[model samples]
Target chain A: MPLDTSTYALAHLRLDGRRWNELRRLHAQISTQAAADGSSYLEQGNTKVLCTVSGPQEQKGGRGGARDQGNEAKVDVEMNIAAFSGMDRKRRARSDKRVQEMQVTIASAFQSTLFTHLFPHSTITVTLHILSQDGSLLAACLNAATLALIDAGIPMSDYISSVTVASAPSSDQSLDEMDPLLDLNGLEEQELPFMTVGTCGRGPGGGEEKVMVLVMETKVQMARLEAMLSVGIDGCKQVRGILDGVVRSHGKRVLESKVS
Target chain B: MAPYTGIPLSPAELSYLHTSLSQHPPIRPDARSPTAFRPLIAETDILPAANGSARICFADGTEAIVGVKAEVEKTPSASSHSINSHSINGEVADEGVRGLGSGGVRDVEDDGMDVDGGEDGKQSSKGRDEWLEVAIDIPGMRDDDALPVFLSAMLTEALLADGALKDKLYINTRFHWRLYIDILLLSLPLSYPLPLLSLTTHLALLATRLPALVSEKDEDPLFNDDWEASTHLYPPTKDETARQKPPITLLVMSVGENILFDPSREELAVADAVVAISVTQSHTNTTGPDADADADADSPNPLHLIALRTIDPPSRLTAAGLPNSLNTSAGAGAGAASQSLSSVEVAVTREKDQGVSVWRPPRGGVKRAVLARMIKMVVQAGGVGEEVLGGLRGVEI
Candidate 1:
């Protein structure tokens, strides 16, 4: 499992046969669970997640009681990993520091992107259940939650889309030849040091995107981080387009049903 | 009643429940008998990454999943001596750098030594408690919250009560298996979830298996390539009939003269007392009933008590019945001053008709008689403990 560039170099294709800057096939559906206020199911390659949004309701007896005194709705995230979701059946404790950290990261990412002031003295809970994990787990959860929130009809400043990018390992030591890979799968993720980048608010005339969420768990060369980040942001923009299309089409169907 | 109960019930509602439960044959809300549990959907050996895993869902939509993971960890004692020597060597190196009198070398050496020393300090600091870890996660609770913290501590205490599990973890002189029991509660805001969590943990532990060690005991433990060769953590007896397994805790609630098992949220709202009893399959009671009589005996095994404790019902924390002294005019605007005045008058009229009311939290502490009944229900043969252990044993892998 060391990054052996020889095989990838033979064909400019990644382990999954995708080229540089290519993304895995992403499939998403909104309002999947009728019981939830807002719910969505998303699949990126082998990574799949189901997200539900419940709230903007009264903050019951919880830690949010103190912090919610401000004029903003607290965004709470609860992430659950199915034991059968990964290559191995691993059960992540709800109190796991790593899982809790991811939950905090997702919560804070939306806390800034959503229009929380509109619903003060309340809490917006986003619960994510990871059905399958290939790679880019955190990124997939973010995208799934965004869709579910939109379905919940929660107003947000912009769509927060996330993707993973990694600097390709090269035989030569030159940094210029190091091409960054976009939307890596589980295998590539394990072999390469990658970062998950979430972008919000499309740049005016598509100039630059705002980085709302940037998380890198593995160490990589500082010079290569910029390359990986830029690629991830571009991937997020591409993801946003796909998510936008889904919402618009679903809206069209709803409109047609109403008119009839 | 205490306010912690997520669901609020009116005084009339609480009274009706208490009166009904006080009857000779308690009429449960769900119509289940005093000893009957809510129907549950359960599955075992469902998680691939875990050595053993189980998921259980109650009729009320409460779901709990437990995973048992075991990793071969190097015993710190094996490396503690080496770390001491390495630290001594670092000190010698530090002195050599200072004696050189070169600021460049001293700065670089100082930073490296500090990092090494820090890591060394942390490594040797961990106690024997590092061998086993148990964590519980409920959706809305923090890791340090009283409920999750207490649940984790109780689970750990029950697992280590007999020290058999720890002994099973011993791999060799240099290494041992580190066991992680991770429990996750899917549906949250539950008032009493201890029984659900404990049941899931019991099923998961019963299904757990350890990779067969192909390497010699003195050498680095090597696992066999064939996963089928793996052995169950709680294997059956030599006869391959009855299995030895971890303990399971049951939540029992008392209402007036009746003791209810697996009580629901509404039932707990008016409960007089609640207790959790932990039990494990007995090893010494081999001569117990039907031990030799039945050939294909799938009969319930004898269980021994591990731990028992009373849990405060969440309903006691809720605000007592309405018509209190608190005023409703606090949030009324100036524009609605006259309107608010009229509303206050209406409230006063109703209060006069109903008379002044005062509510206090339910009394604490369990009666000694109720406590004895709770224990008997769990530990007595053919009781709740036996029924649960037998049910898990019948689960098809």
Candidate 2:
């Protein structure tokens, strides 16, 4: 709640004291599930997500049909939202439309990045579980998936980092002076028009320069569209920096234990 | 969604399990006795997010996690009907719901799910028994599938039979509590699932807490802010019968000729006949001018048999030697048992008084001795119910 109505500015950009460009505080870990080939748990503020990657293994016969497609092993994505994830208990069926849509979004995004030609006639499964929700559900899922894929030692073109940027209130309080809020949370998300952008690590344009991997927006005002995109891409870059740090630290730790 | 068919066994393995269970002393692969229950490891209030929660694990690789969430809802009848609570409150002592029967043996007929067959306890209006909702989710099965549906129905029926939930959850004439109990069968053993499911529901309901209603004025209900002042689902006291017991379903497995309780999945596979019986104890009030009550009071038999149900078995059994499934006995209450409860029916009811109130017995003949022993074991399990109440009392959360 802002004190001065005249200013029309938010007292703070978010519930947490994050600058317009500041991403939520994130903590990521890899290789947590021994049963799955690769797994990662990511917590951004109060939002928690666990991603497990299994496969490049034998595909069950009859399901895929005739080893038809010569290359490009199919990737299956399953997303489970625990009934207790929300404030109110809501049980979603296994075949929920929303869950299936999310799965397709993730599968298609990774289909372009993962080196599927390496493992033909096989399948890889990515399962994402939402343990808790604060906001930016889609972006958090993508971030967790990237780490899990890396942990599984899957070959990808580069880190596929994503973030959500929403139209935020400006300090000026003028209707015209709107700011883009990075990493929208459950509260801000419900009110603001936001966009989720997934970007690759390297430069934006050229061969594989098509750095923009995914862009999902639900009815946005045309005027602020460009701002949300720029802010979202910048947020993704910052996220990539954090993911790079985790993977490097994980590698160093593994090497240290092996030497010891 | 991949079908989660749990632990499939081959024919050879099935035979191996059968041979082991049929042995003279019952040499279980896990070395358990005929009546030995798997050691239960449990904790309650772990899921503080829910109003109340409990998790129980067993050695047979079965795990049940239950969470009871209570929501405050306006009682539908409260607005339209000024239920004559005032009249009933004075004459009908809270504990005097001693059930409806005046002591007569009768075969419990399969009166369908809504059997009004309780003779002695206090009868709350039939509509009040509608609050509890039980759902079971085993990873591999669909929510609408047969296994989960049957398990949920059995759990809800057993819990509702005594109307204990409605008793404790009633807040005021205008308001009441609705409990949504979710039983997550995280893992199912190869055998009977009722015992684990029942125990989990029992412990979870015991750990349930409802807000304390403290009103400054008479008309509307207000709640106290202190969580410590909240009350347990079952009132804490010496007179346990003042409330209904959390009904538990026990798996009765017939191996060769021996009757076993809480058989593992392997034993369940090869057992000649399997029956999962839901049992709860009602009061056998001796204070009433009834000869049967006096006889029972004198004989040291005070526990009255409440609701009994039989679950379908996994395999077929030949029914030549089995006891009648619809053995109602006395506790089928007076309201609905008018047609079934008769003096001429006294002999059959007396026979049922040996305490098997299930709908149908297992296919193969269970000797008279074995059936009698089964009832005695069920009755004896009631004493342990007190220990469970005590255990629930110790749950910190």
Candidate 3:
């Protein structure tokens, strides 16, 4: 059945008012647990993520194959979306496509930056559990994952931050109606085609600039690729800045707690 | 190594293999020696909320955090008699004496004991003996099975052997104190050597500091003196003073025949065997036959000598003789080979009195020789000294 355009438009406007380019207010707390090797809880707008890291220990059997370089380590990434995390309830599946994709993306991002070869034949597993999802769930997960990694004291080339961009057909009929919006929420995502990008470090041009570590796009026109990419990259850079600030403040607080 | 025929190879893989095999002596592009360790960065007391905390980062991006919390509780009645009665008095003596008086006290005291000591009569019956529990959380790696429990057990053993906790101080006390050390590990790049990283966690505890406190109840029962003001307060005897600092543990991982100190996640990936060494300083009496002659002369600083030694090895695939088989064909023979290799032994040596050592594992053959040389080069590049090296040898893996 064809969807009602009018209702969708209203939802889109409401989401837009929430701000496409502006990130949701972020709150991060470090060292949330005593037993974990490292742990952090991150909330991005309505999206909440709790991340924990454990083990540079010997890699488990089956996971450590013969071809694995004796001196090369491996990373295992796991993402769990609670049954109540989404607006629509989700049933748990051990190997769902979406969950698997997230796992791969997270593993790739950490792999590129982490010095895995230092620990030979060992495995570092990062688990990200989403308690709630409003929109930009992946971006929020990445941010939480990085914080947890830092808390764990894992070495990294740099911190990775993510942002989502949506391209809506412009109302003006003359040109192809496609304008890039930043930091899309669930409502905005449902109305327009959008893409999410995760990037490292800060960017230039008053925001932050860095290459995209992972990119995922929903439906979108090929003609607007360049513009959408630009906006998405910019949004990522901005997100990185926010994440950087959060990490710095978190580290300071952790240190201060120890002294006090 | 033969390429698998079943799977199609990407251009990147083809080139990686070609270049890797073509290079003389077959060195990785990163130029790290076989046993070379990546950089290590450690921050102690990283978590302020924790009683004691530490975070260690390996160059390869593997990180682990450890927090120690101390809580007070009554010791088990069955074990109360085993506690050293000399250290505690008054209320403590009453509790210990009452618990030791009858087995009926076991029912009362058992409820107060922690869950871990429920089974052991010796451990559970004690009223004055304190217990330390170490919990390890590996974020995403925790399984419904035994992984979490295993990690906790490994850490607990390490902490006990760490020589940091003042077990003697808590003995015979009315309230038996238990120090809970919780470790949270995150990220852990896949390339890290699991055994080495676990060993690092063990070693990091060596630097953990415990407050120095001695009871003044013997000299000033009312606690009226400004503690330090009481001259009658007994100083920690030589033996007690020697136990003040925790023993330091150092971790060294070997790739093939080479040994590296404090291997990072990346460096651990290529290591063949990892060893942790823990060192402690003990005072030996100078009353031997030769001591009589030396006693007449001015003694040199009492010779508070430090000794280096090896701790228990951690459980790892490599340590278990199961070589990493990512590139190998799957079969029964491969499993057997892995089991055999798990027993491979690495060599270690103490280099100085500063509690460090230089380790040189036996080269299995010519192929391993290359790896050994590479590790040596990496250690040299890092400028690790005898103290650091020997310390690594003493850590409990």
Candidate 4:
């Protein structure tokens, strides 16, 4: 049951004490893994992810020599979901259909963002280790990967920030009480039909924003989808604010340390 | 992980461990007895998303998590295979599904349970037969790797081969409970590899709860609104006839003159032979006629060894049998990987027919006495299964 609070809009639901529109308390750090060129550790609620970026160096041994893109650097993403990261002790094969799909999705999402053409013939490898999973696995991975890339000083058009929003009516109440909950956690995610939205080119009324990735695994009504998309977009922009602040402050700290 | 052929050892290191293990009482790195189990810490019913979930951690830093999700899929229309293809593929009438036009993943992937093979071949010819799917994920290993394929097939067989699990899953012929049991491997065991996977999955299965079937409407299994009303897979064993005990796997290693119950990476390196035996509380389990005698005997444990897999000598999980050279990066990278995974899945399904197929055979044959002792130790370990069953009572799900 949703406890009646100052924000009554979240009343009908929210088992985790988060408001309908509120994001999970996010704790992010850059350069978390010392070995990687750029690395980041991000936590959104209970979902914890570590991302490391290596290369833009020479291409490794090639098995598929036929379709190598001479211009854009190949972006290889390997996502590891730790067995102890979840409530279950489940180990997945690396070539799991979902894992492969995630790899493809993340690689393509960052492909357009990175100036791949700048480092032709070289490969940029992004590896994400999911240490804990609460909910919003894809969104958290996307967000953490973005920060890691930025930390590596990889060129990109804009900072990609992502969030997942779900229509939580069936799980909490009837469909008539359709409420689009932002940044859903593990439990809510199972009950609701959710979509992950990634946005870039975000600023305070500076210019129109761009939608980089909008993935909806479950079906949602067309009319309600519009509403969910708007809410998800707003969630992404808000996340961008936190991420941008971290990036700017990180840049300042690095410069100051260099001068010192 | 590729059954880590013992740890990477120089000739000197290998000789050292080989000589040490050969001594009486096994004077090796760990001072524990040959049969002593490493520490195992476990938690169950942790994931709210899964009907049943559990994580098991070993002292050696290796860990695994398992989640069991019970979903109701419409029984594959046994009569309309060709007709269904016409609807999905329009006019592509290829039964092999390989040449099916614009092949989506479902058209290719077995979706886990396709019991059209195995000893119970053609079981899918009638009503819903295949109701179980097991997926094991090892971090960083490619899908088609020999280790993953072998592990997945072995785990799936551990659960489904006996039909005890599937009998419990059958709500009705129209709609059977399909358990998508996903096991994620966190780390590789340094030495011994046996029960790390089996125990985690056993607990996960024990902790699994199936949604209550409110009613069957038009071949669909409608579930109750309250998840608390769900039924546990291993519910307290109030009635002996309906009971289906979780299967436990034991990794048996034979080093020199010794039959080690649990081998470390170093011990495995020097191991002469390895056998993975899956045991479960016995019932009228007539599925595998080659079942151990204890299945029919009266003992403290009604357990029986259901499946025994032999790993031939020193098949290093790291690099020995990897087909890395075959993977060529190209425009259809995802498609290529998907194709390879499907092929590996087919190969995995075929493994059921070859009873005791060796993944990679360890060379030296063990003394008959050593082999006999290993069996005795495994039978004694059945108490651990009962203790685990006791632990399942605490699983809130």
Candidate 5:
């Protein structure tokens, strides 16, 4: 039988000290490349990603090919986990399921925000190289990809940020009352039935607005799904504000350099 | 002709060519319509670090990025004899006859076009035949001289055709206001059609945006005794010139019997001949007196007008003969079998008004229809339209 929901729910919560709803600090840097069309480096707590964007170049291949004439642009995303990135060893290969999932997820997240049709028949590839993984690897990857795209000066609808939340199972407790954690690390991730939500816009509590782009639920009870989603969604809003600040400051630096 | 060495033409290729022509009465693949154009997209200022930059992405997945950077250099004396020599700043010191001399309109006519007639006229005569050098640098790629030559010629043609660098704007042509454009390509499929693949080339140009020179007054004249000395005391202020937007080229590729808007890598692999056409818009600013009087009241306003046209001569398969009809349905499958048996003659007339023709090997019965249809597809795919097709029909292939 599957592990008891109650046993894993908030099983590892350190209630006496740190609050369950608290989030880990996030940091990001932009304009990391001299040659690429755009480049950025982002780190959320322990998860880290380096992204590089190139092209709006000629469509490769023979003439009259799709990239030859129209406004449709192509996007290629590659995500690789180094052997030393995680606590456990990672094999040197692209066939891993986790890496593939990250690639698709990151690509999908950017695709929704990017005005690809404006580029018609052309391709823009976003490469994400994961240097380290703690927890919320997907969230970090998404954040890094967004920043890199902005640095590349690729136009976008808005920025995307992601957060993870764990739900404490208690039949006696109201679903809304369940403690919502933010930015789960590997240790927290291993012990809780959490969900990851990537949102665009700001967060509540006077932060940034939020628009949900992706959601991944891991080992959460169906009954507590709504409660967990709200928690994750709220946490994502908070993260978005922090990421936006980073982007703004970075932009300021770039502008200053141009001025000076 | 036997397939070029190991490059064997597939049977499917021959059959597709024949079938499309016979069924649809397709237009000749080589005949392009005046208005029909391949699609194009351009992004400017793509490289912020570069002085000027642009990227042109075509539908066929062929893309090119061009970056332009400018540097200051002392004007070389030897270049005075060059075709564009008078354009050099120090070489033409006499500004009076040349409006560059600080004289008003009347002085301009008297000196600008006549004073240096002997030297300027010689330069003007040679200008028509002069060639500008184009250099291309691709990181880690083999040096392909043909690519640079083709790209440079196309760029020069576009600049002239669009009048982007009219004589007025490009005043300092002699001092080697070299524009360096670098192109980087990320995706180019091997089976890519020539026409479409050609579109991915990116072009970026850098030139000094010199402000209009104005005369300045000199206060301290104790050391300057002569009128020429006082006049030379004050020089025009040279403001920091901002980089202008780089010119963009939109490439359109036509393939197969049909014109696929933007074919992907997979689709390009199967296509026959491809044609890549670059289109740029020319903008001309009318400021001088000569321009004002000649401007017609009833004609469309020419101020900052965009004139759209092709940049370079469209390339085609050299060995193929011109097609006889725009309609391809004259014959059927038998045409492919008989293509090897027939011999044809071809005469190339290199004029814009003269149409290009591709002659297929003669076939009997249904084969004729197939051959005709195949040729039709090629012409239509080449962006040729009804009028061009009509013209092609009038000519012997």
Candidate 6:
């Protein structure tokens, strides 16, 4: 119904009137839920997610599954999609295969990023609720979980900022003609190939990004994949800047209030 | 105080707590007065995705968040046919007769100020009970657990008690609004959490706004895109004094002769009885001939009681040791004298010196007079309800 990839040649504008390499609006707030050790609500355009982090506290019961190693703390990720999150009202089962796979991916990504050895025999649970979905659901959840863990005072190697990058369908089979879109929405996601990229690092444009998560579910030409990866990495850096700004401003406000 | 995780109080410490509580002016563990609530930090309109949202945190690390979202739904055609009536004058007459007897508070609950006119108002608002859907999420509890289920029911009842909220949801004869209230308890609660949850819900509801509708009459409703054009779901009164506010539930506990509001877990563990009292503002003073002239006076706003529910205090596991009052001995004379004679001697002497002894279980139920007194302390003029209402009035929404 709206503009699609074929229209990119007309004015070089993708859907929603954004050119390639332009990201959607990003907004985030931490410590929104005081009951949890750390919590955050993040919005990337129309996609919204709420995340809460609990523990590093001692694990209860004897069921130490594969996720919970004896020598290091365990990271558990749970995802819940509201029935009204999408345009249609469909209830997701608790054992949905796709959801379970995403949960594992998120858990493993954070397992390495956090210093789990510091809290042996404990568990850190990150629960995420998707309030709305447009596209880039995993990226929004990852970013929100990162902020919540930071608010929970967990030690992490670096901030893990994430975003999605899509490769625009080309008119011809030439490398020069292929364009990489920085962000994808629900409509574009259905018609284009996209990959979510996450990077952990300090400082802006530091030139070294330790990519922690890279997941691509759709098929794309080998020639187009490299450009999408690079664009995705660049988008991650920008997301890191925004996340850092939110943390700094929030910390300043907290400090000022405590001091006064 | 470490509560619910096996209270760590020994017999001596238990006795000391009992003695301190039985004093004429009970000294709470946190040094708050019997009526003073613990200080809390709260914020409203934080969640951008939801129509209205609020978060509240107590000093003891308990926190709760509430979000209210509204969606337009088509009214069920079956109910309209069943309750349809042509006697518009009859309903109007009944409403007027009731409005004159009570004040503004009842007026809101009874018929929602009767602003929508008599024709299809009752028809459109018929099946309003199912309009509000409440879903509560607490970290370690299932949705069907007693606490969550009870909480969901209580919150739904308090909001729908006066039917004012249902009146607001009426869009037209063919359509209405349904609210989805989602509450998340961030941390495990130590005391009864009804008050914390209810207060946060009230703030969230207060901040909720519905998009202004552009389409007129029974056609499909079209909302104005501009968010600034939206109107508040619970608008403040024209005079800025009183409004159609949601009822707020508060927890009150009695220990011995003392009545406490917002009791901490420690106080609740030893409470003789606990009750949740819900109240709303009654604009009784706003009426009468001298209403304008008396508006400037320093009279406190009156509150009307909506509901009073008794909650079981957390198990008295640690408080059932020895009696604090010297006159009452918990055990039989032989048992008190035989094996523990020396310890009993020491306890008796210590009780004489410090007016402290052993903790004894609350023998029976709370007196009718005490329950009445607790109600009076909460609902009376310049009472606990007024204080809470006054405090919330200053919060920016």
lDDT of 1: 0.75
lDDT tens per residue, model 5, B1-397: 5323222334344334433433343333333241344344555544323434445555433444544433222224324445334565533442212221111211211111222223322223222212222334332233355654555555544343322232222223233223333444433322333332223222234222222222232221122233233211012122211111213333223333344323333233223333333222111222346654674542221211111222221122112332433223446554444444423311222121122233232222223333333223322323232222222222211
Per-candidate RMSD, Å: 14.3, 13.0, 18.5, 15.3, 20.1, 6.6
Give the TM-score of each candidate: 0.67, 0.66, 0.40, 0.57, 0.37, 0.79
Error of 2 at B209 (Å): 3.9
Q: Rank the candidates by TM-score, best first.
A: 6, 1, 2, 4, 3, 5
**Backbone clashes (count) for model 6:** 4
Judging by DockQ against the true structure, name the best candidate. Answer: 6
Weakest 10 consecutive residues of candidate 2 chain A by summed lDDT: A1-10
Interface RMSD of each: 4.4, 4.6, 12.4, 7.2, 15.0, 4.0
Candidate 2 recovers a fraction of native contacts equal to 0.00
Candidate 2 lDDT: 0.66
Query: Candidate 2 chain B — worst ten consecutive residues by lDDT sum?
Result: B97-106
Better by lDDT, candidate 4 or 1: 1
Error of 5 at A86 (Å): 1.0
DockQ of 6: 0.32
Per-structure clash totals for the candidates:
13, 30, 93, 34, 94, 4
Candidate 4 retains true contacts at a fraction of 0.03
TM-score of chain B of each: 0.73, 0.67, 0.45, 0.66, 0.41, 0.78
* DockQ comparisons of all candidates to the true complex: 0.10, 0.13, 0.03, 0.06, 0.02, 0.32
lDDT (10s digit) by residue, model 4, range B88-191 = 45333422232211112112112122222233322212222246777666645666777777887777666654445765776654566677777776554344
Whole-model lDDT values for every prediction: 0.75, 0.66, 0.51, 0.67, 0.46, 0.75
For model 1, residues A1-260, the per-residue Cα lDDT tens digits are: 77767778778788778998999999999976554678888999888887888888877666634645678898999888865567554666677998999999999999988999999888899999875688999999999999999999999988899999988876564766688999988889888888999999778885356898999988888888877887888899999999999899888988999999
Best candidate, TM-score: 6
lDDT tens digits, residue span B172-284, model 6: 77788988888877677767788999999988998999999999987789999999999899886654445657779999988788888898877776777888877766433
Clashing pairs in 6: B109-B162, B321-B359, B322-B358, B322-B359
The better-scoring model by DockQ among 1 and 6 is: 6
